[model samples]
Target: MKQSQPRYIMVGGFLGAGKTTAILKLAEHLKRQGRAVGLITNDQGTGLVDTAMARASDFPVEEISGGCFCCRFNSLVDATRKLTATTRPDVLIAEPVGSCTDLMATVTLPMKQLYGENYRIAPLSVLVDPIRAMRVLGLGGGRQFAPKVTYIYRKQLEEANLLVVNKCELLDATQTAKLVAALKQNFPKADVFAVSARTGDGLAAWFDRILTGELSATDIMDVDYITYGVGEAMLGWLNATARLSGSPVDGNELLLRIGCALRDRLAKADAEIAHLKMTLTATGDGLDIAVANLVRTDAVPELSFRLAEPFTEGELTVNLRAQAEPALLERIVREVAGECGAALGSLASFKPGQPNPTHRVDAGGVEHRPVLP
Candidate 1:
């Protein structure tokens, strides 16, 4: 007789999709059901917003940094094994990099084909931000992506076993219905659901499905190897940590200003902000400091920090994304911190930092060595 293994559920999405929030809600739900949960976060670089958010939950969070789970498949397995060893969780939820796709072939298919004896792969649920969906599908006028970026976005949806329309609360019923209809017509085989992680709407049904669902491998997309490779190569990732000294500024206000400032700056530079997120965890006080992500400058920010208490000192983690150069991202962080310090009537200390690039794949299907700064 063999020991029962933990169920593995992976939630994936394009840039700015609400995968992190959905995972948090799902973890909470599972915990309420008396199940211990373990979380794994993947990112293209070392400093990841998702990792910080997941860790803040105080759960057993493991991070597979510098690569998506597919490119780092062995690391994914190792992380799962470590999580299993420590927590023996009933369920394990993993969130992959936002810009990544082709999970069915690279991740799910391999997992089922190789690790079926030790774990069960839940349906691969890919989340779509309504705004991004509209932009990618040409339903609304927004920043147009280069051909390669567009290719990755579409490929992400192409491999999903479940397509979830996220941030639906921002749209009216009619608008939501229109999007859902279009998604259904386009991806007829996958089950599509509308969920607002912010409001907990339609999550219960989604949860129910996850609990009883079986993930059969789907037909993965044939990606343009070269184009796919270049698109990913052009993108640079940066995550940083900063020590702040402020006079007990309102955490929410500070986060709002910082997020808006960064969004505005990135927009002026004509750089696409795939996701710019920051999390502030205070040291002494019990209050949740602040967390905000700007998927788009024009869109409303998402908050990961809910105030349960207040604190005077803390560490702040900044996760930035842009189509600009990696150096540009570092500069942007410095400028944002200066502005935030001035607003708070004090100065915040930011140390020199570099994004540790974990994965670099080209369209030719060539893998590059990880770049560390």
Candidate 2:
């Protein structure tokens, strides 16, 4: 008989929750163990930051754009097959859209119930950004989401087989303990861990658990189609590309400045940032230069992407989100590039385009159509 195919492991999280970073850490760990790895990335639009990040590792990266893995299930399976054929990886790592949830019903359950023979579906792992979690759970003084956004976020946690508290490096022991306790209370069945993908802290434990088959099917939530529809309808996404050349500044610094500038501009324009993320990769090193995230513009930004060393030459890829018009996003990119160039004493070029949405739903039936410029 053919050797058992590699297990399918998925890392899911809300927007700006460090899924890409965590996935990268896990990929490295698995590779060190002499296991071949394949990666699949899903997003609502093309030119995704996660795809770029994954490809930077020289892994076989397949992207399913224009929708989540759930709605674009065929694309996901096809991408998996392509990765399997191309890399023959011992393990597959798939990162779904951060804004998405209900993986059990959409991806995991289907994989287990239908494609059980070809692949062993590992437990679905969900990552949460501590700051975002605090804000969403109303523990922080951040703006409260109108019922719809709140519903979507809660549903994301409900279906997780493993709930990971990412970016725990920012928290103290007491804070970490509180978050862990909260997660336990909320998701009693799921294994909860505090990890910092950037620093490689607590990752070994997580890696061990994931590799040791510690997860099982249990107590997955029943998703409400209507609420899910409303949750999706209320969000807006933007993906854009920019060209930059500056005095050899750290790539991480460039990303941080650019992300902050755009985020501030959007905030001034009265936009609520659901997630604003940007990735800069050096062409020479073939590695990520910088990555930054802002779950809300009013909140302090988080650095999700970083480099151990700096790069002098590379282009920047940005994915920004706000409860505002697409044109505004384009404008913000243009303005931020100019600002970044001025600071670096170099010319920055920006090319903005409409984000091609892969998934669109109006569960509230409010007919709140997004206006594009």
Which residue ranges in model 2 land beyond 4 Å of their true spot? 1-3, 246-252, 282-285, 299-314, 338-373
User: Per-residue lDDT for 259 in model 2?
Assistant: 70
| Pairs of residues at least 3 apart in sequence or in different chains that clash in candidate 2 | 66-358
Residue 355 alpha-carbon offset, candidate 2, angstroms: 17
Model 2: how far residue 244 lies from native, Å = 2.5
What is the per-residue lDDT of model 1 for residues 1-373, given as tens digits with 9 covering 90 to 100? 2238778898888877988889999999988988899999987667566776776677889998766787788899899999999999988999988877777667776676677788887888999999889888877887866777778888888777789998889999998898888888877877999999989999988887776688764555555556666676556566777666657667676667777877777778787887788777777642355788888656656676754544356777777765667777767777887765532222222211222223333323344433332
* RMSD to true structure for each model, in Å: 5.4, 6.3
Provide the TM-score for each candidate, comma-separated.
0.87, 0.83
lDDT of 2 by residue, 52-106 (tens): 7787777789998877787788788899899888888888889988767767666
- Give candidate 1's error at residue 121 in angstroms: 1.2
Error of 2 at 368 (Å): 27
